[model samples]
Target: MPRGRGNRRQQDPIGGREQLPQWVRKEAQQPQRVVRNLRRRPPADADEEAPLEKRRRVDERQLVAMHPDVDFQKLLGGCDRLYKSKDLREPITIDILIRLNAALRHVCSSRYETIMFQTALNLAFAAFLRVSEFALSSNVIHEHVLHRRDVYIDHVKNQLFVTIKFSKTDQKGRSTTLVVDKNESNEICPLHSLKAFLQIRPGNDGPVLNKGL
Candidate 1:
């Protein structure tokens, strides 16, 4: 079975007509596949797998060290503010989206296509509100899989989708989760909105969307 990422529906405020995109519909009708293929946890005394996790931890530590003044509290605070605001739209402009698409297009490989980049971007944005996260390090966001068997053996089959957790802060500095669902937790909710606004059609429009080969 493909990893189920769930579904999303858009409703017009004026006409109240609910709409679901074609890609979303297709994804619903078929099993969804993702690029990530790694075990969520290490096996018992697996010396070879230990090195990979160790390297990842070391890299994460180094990344944190490189930015000693990350101010995670501040970052979290900003995201909280955005989440609470009445504006349901995201702040990213079309220019930024276009630039990202262009860059991905330039580096297309024989194996990977634009949709992979698009979904990766979507997942990254879902995790972090800013595109800068992806721009800063595409490697971190890109989920690479060597083969189908690797995906299962690695225990990472179809785990590429992201989930958002909605929460609120109280005066006591404690946080309370309001909702935890895929549809509500979409970080690219704004970008998705913009895509809808532009009426982007699904076809061979360069980097916009590479639906099928």
Candidate 2:
């Protein structure tokens, strides 16, 4: 499903009409498909999937909406639980940051893209960020993902803060700030990497994570 991630409003305040992305509209307009090969009857239905317990049931519909992945699986769940619970995944830990940064830089098309990946990875880990906080999302609007203007760095404190202007959790549009301080080792340092990245900053046309690729 396409989600809004930038600051642009997708709906008129008074009209209440949805101004969804064209691609999302097109996708919704497309006919739904079913598998003729399936002989077994579906086990779950829509009503059963609602939030009856503390958490929504993980059924076929829920699984399909999950937008499957392996490393991410067991790590994340349905979007309805997005901000309700905290993420306690261990794989996106700092212990493997250096290795991940190295691998990203190894295959980047340019010095710009490499710096972006390194900076993004370090800041994300250090600040405990969600991808939707700074990356370009499906609709690229309404979700309020951070752009370059949202980042503030303190050279004296050796820290960088990301200002999230709005979010699903903060429907009132109240701003929240997340900080990433300097690491002892420059190899996996969010502060150091962020400074270096700003020195050779990439395109500022969109989301901070956008490489213009």
Candidate 3:
């Protein structure tokens, strides 16, 4: 019987069925390659876990075998100590604030700047205000920022009322009023400093410490 093209068997140059074409071998190996890759890949949960979380799990497992009296949190306090030891911030005292005001008098370019700095320093110290409470983030003014309208001076009572609309502690926007009284010293008194700044301050509605004013 004569063999047709479709009935003929195709063989490699080596004349062996085992030695097939490169594409045919590749196609046959693809399933095995995929299986090997799947075996090497980590589980989804393991991949998502952080190094700290992994360390915590290991510690927890070790803790299960340890004594009940062992305080893990107390042991972790060492890390906090190491972090705090590197911190550079120091507590600001009254003496430091006074010295800073004196330095500003010489360093400030103009009387406007001097008064502004002095007022801000004293007010922040007296009111225990964060930088965000009394100062704008940038040149742009926001509705939540302390404005001229927020300040009310009671000359009769000799007190200054400053309304803080937004604060870290008060996220709900429930406003809080700070009452600043006159001090014996004219230099560091928040009320006196504020009054001095207001005298030269422009009669415009904006942030209390704005340079544009």
TM-score of every model versus the real structure: 0.21, 0.54, 0.59
Candidates sorted on lDDT, descending? 3, 2, 1
Kindly report which residue stretches of model 1 are placed more than 4 angstroms away from their true locations once superposed. 1-92, 111-113, 126-161, 164-213
Instruction: Name model 2 segments beyond 4 Å from true.
Output: 1-90, 140-143, 202-206
lDDT of 3 by residue, 20-58 (tens): 455665788785423336656454455666665656667
Best of the candidates, lDDT: 3
The whole-model C-alpha lDDT of candidate 2 against the native structure comes to 0.73
TM-score, model 1 to reference: 0.21
List pairs with backbone clashes in candidate 3: none
lDDT of 3: 0.81
Number of clashes recorded per candidate: 2, 4, 0
Candidate 1 vs candidate 3, lDDT winner: 3
Best by TM-score: 3
Tens digits of per-residue lDDT for model 2, 1-213? 545554354785689976766676799999865645577533345235445532444665665667654434545665447657676777776668878888986798888888888888888788777777767767646348878788888989888888888776875778898877778998788788777777776565456666554
Per-residue CA lDDT of model 1 for 13-69, tens digit only, reads 789987666677787999644436475554536456787676666654676777897
Segments in model 3 whose C-alpha atoms lie over 4 Å from true places: 1-86, 139-141
lDDT of each: 0.43, 0.73, 0.81
